[model samples]
Target: MATYDAALVLLVDSSEAVLLQHRDDQGLVSPNQWSLPGGHVELGETPEQAAHRELFRETGLTTSELRALWSGPWPYEAASRIR
Candidate 1:
């Protein structure tokens, strides 16, 4: 089993529209797909910190307000089996 920590940010607008980014076709993961702005948590960084960092790095946007919607170890083995 392998464990990886990651974080993602969901940005909503006043019109109730959500923001998403298209991954580069040449990218390593989920190429040419729409995804929320986020990435893996860096060393010595909390998930919240990583979320903020990833949001800024990917979208050039920053916010002081962020709330966790979910946090836990997702059952990777079961998820992989579904795919």
Candidate 2:
């Protein structure tokens, strides 16, 4: 089986509501759907590093603080669904 790595961030407000983005309608997958900020990990980078990079790139937000909650392989079906 093949495998890959990805990173994501869950930003929450004082109200405990999660921060979400409405994907551009022009996005290739799940367009217009609301989701957190994230993307695939790049070579020589850790998931947390990728999460920070993606968060800034996608949302123009940056942070030096991060706490990993978990790590694991993505389901084959879901991974395959993405490009």
Clashing residue pairs in candidate 2 are: none
- For model 1, the stretches where C-alpha displacement exceeds 4 angstroms are 73-83
* TM-scores, all models, native as reference: 0.81, 0.77
lDDT of 1 by residue, 25-68 (tens): 98655679999987666679888998999999999999999998
> What does candidate 1 score on TM?
0.81
Q: Where is model 2 more than 4 Å wrong at Cα?
A: 1-3, 75-83
Give candidates' CA RMSD values in order.
5.0, 2.9
Summing lDDT over every window of 10 consecutive residues in candidate 2, give the lowest-scoring window: 74-83
